[model samples]
Target: MNTLLIFIGCGLVTYFSRASFILFGDRVKLPETVQRSLAYVAPATFAAIMVPAVLGDDGLANLVPPSPQVGAIVIAGFAIAKTRNMAVALGAGMISLWLLQWVGL
Candidate 1:
């Protein structure tokens, strides 16, 4: 019961925090620098996640590069560049990885 109340409290705080922006956007103008920084957050976050998955050894340090995974990432990057759609890139990357696996990569 206590845990549930904590979760509900957190959810309400999150909801109100976001709702505040919509509730007073016109009156509260963010600084240009902050807006610019916010614009880069999505891409920066993406790189932070993807770079590690692509470069880091699955769990431990390994001298050899995982070529199959890298190849899939490259193909996904190309799909994103060309199509500019994350869903398409995700599907293409998943298919590429599955095919590579089935082919005994």
Candidate 2:
């Protein structure tokens, strides 16, 4: 009974918090700097996640030149930027990596 009540209370609070945003957001205009910063949050966050995943050794930062992952990243970035197609970029990058590995380069 106590747990059920607590769950209901939490749900009501969460609903109100989200509902408040929709109710009041249209009336509020964020500052330009904040809006601009918000625009970068996604890409910056993506890079923050991906960079370490690509470069980390045992989850530690390892910055070295001629890294194959770096080459794949560059190719992927170019493919995505030019074509704006995630599937194509990923496919091309994976194929490229396989080729490089097979050729022993």
Candidate 3:
């Protein structure tokens, strides 16, 4: 079927992309520029993912949540800047989101 073919194609592509590293990781010596560029891939990927989750409704679909998504981001940002701890920031952000949702804020 078309769906099964699509799945197989995507899986093969992902597998090869990852397997290249496992197979030839030590053999490859990338340039400094390439290495530096690769560092941004993580934040770029995070933004790519988070942008959709954050703006999915209000920015595009015109259906905004009560108030807490934006607030949660702000709180988490501050938490990271202040504490520099991912666990603490994530906990604070989740708790804030829950409270905001419960209070309809």
Most TM-score-accurate candidate: 3
Q: Give the TM-score of candidate 3.
A: 0.70
| Predictions: Cα RMSD each | 3.1, 5.0, 3.5
Per-candidate TM vs. native? 0.67, 0.62, 0.70
Q: What is the lDDT of residue 54 in candidate 2?
A: 77
lDDT of 1 by residue, 1-105 (tens): 699999999999999999998987889889999988998989999899977877666633321545567768888999999999999999999899888777766
User: Which rank order by TM-score, best down to worst?
Assistant: 3, 1, 2
Supply candidate 3's per-residue lDDT for 38.
95
Better candidate number, 2 or 3, judged by TM-score: 3
**What's the TM for model 2?**
0.62
Show pairs that collide, candidate 2. none
What C-alpha lDDT values do all the predictions have? 0.82, 0.78, 0.83
Q: Model 3, residue 80: what's the lDDT? A: 90
Candidate 3 clash pair list: none
